[model samples]
Target: MESLRELFKIGFGPSSSHTMGPQRAASKIKEQYPNASRFEVELYGSLALTGKGHLTDYIIKQTLGKQTIVRFKSDRLPYHPNGMKFYVYQDEEILDTITAYSIGGGTVEYEGSKLQQTKQIYPHKNLKEIIQYIEDNGISFYDYVLNYEDEHFKAYLFEVLDSMFTCVQNGLHHEGVIPGRLQLKRVAKSMYQQAINTRRESDRERLLVSSYAYAVSEENACGNKIVTAPTCGASGILPAVLFYCYKQLEIPRKELIKALAVAGLFGNVIKHNATISGADGGCQAEVGSACAMAAAAYGWILELNNSLIEYAAEMGLEHNLGLTCDPVGGYVQIPCIERNGFGALRAIDAASYAKQLGYLRKNKVSFDSIVNVMKETGKDLNSAYKETSLGGLAKEFGLKDGD
Candidate 1:
């Protein structure tokens, strides 16, 4: 099976499945049809329904303009009046009259009578079909689609892992100390200060302790917050693991990439077999899956057996069972940011405990079984918690009501 690097990626904020995914698909479209003078874009299903709230439209626009999605500045985003349109580049002049949509989970499609529909084995609502009309008598169908669940190639995996490490480090240092929003109760600056004070300790120990301290403060100040995983809305978890590996274990930079690779593999498996988008599977899919990935990575870096890695991964997933994607506001602000810290702490705990318990003797949990449960649970969840901004904290707190 291919590794996880291809499945999970590091990109701009707000969303992975929503913003990043669509941009990725757009790049793929360009890749398959380079040198084309004109191109059109379209969207379908869930992407159309709640794309605006998730910033899917903006992502697609940037993608089709041949801009690099990962590094593009927020102010440079392209804007279009309609959801679909075309771009014509001739004589070094760039003219875009294209139409597109931001399907939830980062999916976008181009619309037209000439469009050719391409189907995938995976069942997802946010589908994109890019059709080009060639002069040849025979018509050709091109599918610039992304499959979240399938195993990805090694080269792709490495690229993503490398990007993720860079993103996290850049976000932490250059992003200028993530502002504390989301009623998180704890403050990023405060936590950072505490982490600094504990600099005498190993990175792993300092990160673990500081995170626990922050979680304690948050619980005391406000209440429980979900982990945002790779995002600030889902932050903390990935950073915690990365910091621990870098500081405590003193893992080399090259080995860190390997660790991330292992982590990405675990995340991709959950995404493929279950869900990673909050719109589809709730917070469990997002944060829970991230925790599971971190745990597996920790185990792998520690040189544990495959069984240990599996155990850590399963523990990470199971512990976060039934989490809901209930951000107070539609923005990835609010509870989303602080939640990452909690998830990261949990991952470390799970990894350490799994090591102590002995993977050889620990009860085995089937990945397939857990995935099935996640899918069933997501189906049973209310629409309010599924990225609709209608339930959970979004509605209960009256944040962005009528928005």
Candidate 2:
């Protein structure tokens, strides 16, 4: 598996696969063909279907030159849904053409090339292998992560943590409708204020956690800087949970960072064994994987056993198995933003349930089994349900470009 740094990325996001991935690809191509007079870019599948709402074309043009031409195609590449072709022209003649795929989580893969060419950091391929390694070594998840990841990874996580906090703070203070056709008014500020005024502790916790999730999700919807716990569309889950632990539970910075390591391990396992791209596996891959990661982090913070932590993570993804990536108006607002709050709440519920049920009995379903099921379920889903914005809520509410 690749490093956690690849799993957790910092960037502007309405959609990672749509905006961040295309931007990165365009920037790289711009560097390679600096003297080229113009460029042509073609977006396929989900990128084309939702490019305008997700700011894919805008980012590409911003990265390359304003003269860049972008075309949208309905056909998809067999390699991945978020696919693109770049044509470089110097004098009305093609200098080069490159095919690439944005394989989710803001990562790109060239034709016939691996998603990431960097050296593999961990030997385990799946959760089963990871569990065996943990048992054999008699080490905690934190120790296992530290053993494989270098010091630089820890420093990078700190930066990610800071960025997440900053995003939440910014969201809570800002009061305006998010930039999109939806005209959705920002609710995080009101939610947080409501949380502060609440009398009951339980309601306070719920509102606070939900507000944090909304804060980050709204920030992402507005194309602000945020960390992708796995991907931009489902970016709010883990941060909301972790921030709640830090502020509400009073957990220290070191412990939260360690929890992040454990969370990344869970997310990496899912990303390797299955998928994390909404365009590939629907919202199940994005929100589900993020919920699992957040659950694992919460379990780690609570000092749960490995089995309990795995159970919590399993439940997180299992409950969200068939969640569709049907963003209304092709923007990462509406269902996408609200789902973050629900996902964070579900993660907390999953972790707490695991901790409370620790002495009852062992869970029959392993996280690995659920991951396999999710992958198969995603394969069976229609393309319309997988980030194309052609079905579900996107279709139910008839809204258009200016509506």
Q: Which is the leading candidate under lDDT?
A: 2
RMSD of each: 11.6, 1.5
Question: What are the per-residue Cα lDDT tens digits for candidate 2 across 104-124?
Answer: 899888884323344678998
| Model 2 misplacement above 4 A | 113-118, 400-403
Model 1 quality (TM-score) = 0.65
In terms of TM-score, the best-performing candidate is 2
lDDT values for all models: 0.53, 0.91
lDDT of candidate 1 over 1-403, digit per residue (tens): 2223334434455565555656666666566556655444443333443345456566666666643222211111132111333444543576433344332223334554233333334333210111112113232111112233344444554455454444444333321322223433335445565566765666636555445424322321221221223332354466457655665567876666667656765665565556666766778877787788788778877777665667777888888878877655455555555566677777777888889987447656754567668778977887567665667777787765113
Ten-residue region with minimum lDDT total, candidate 1: 126-135
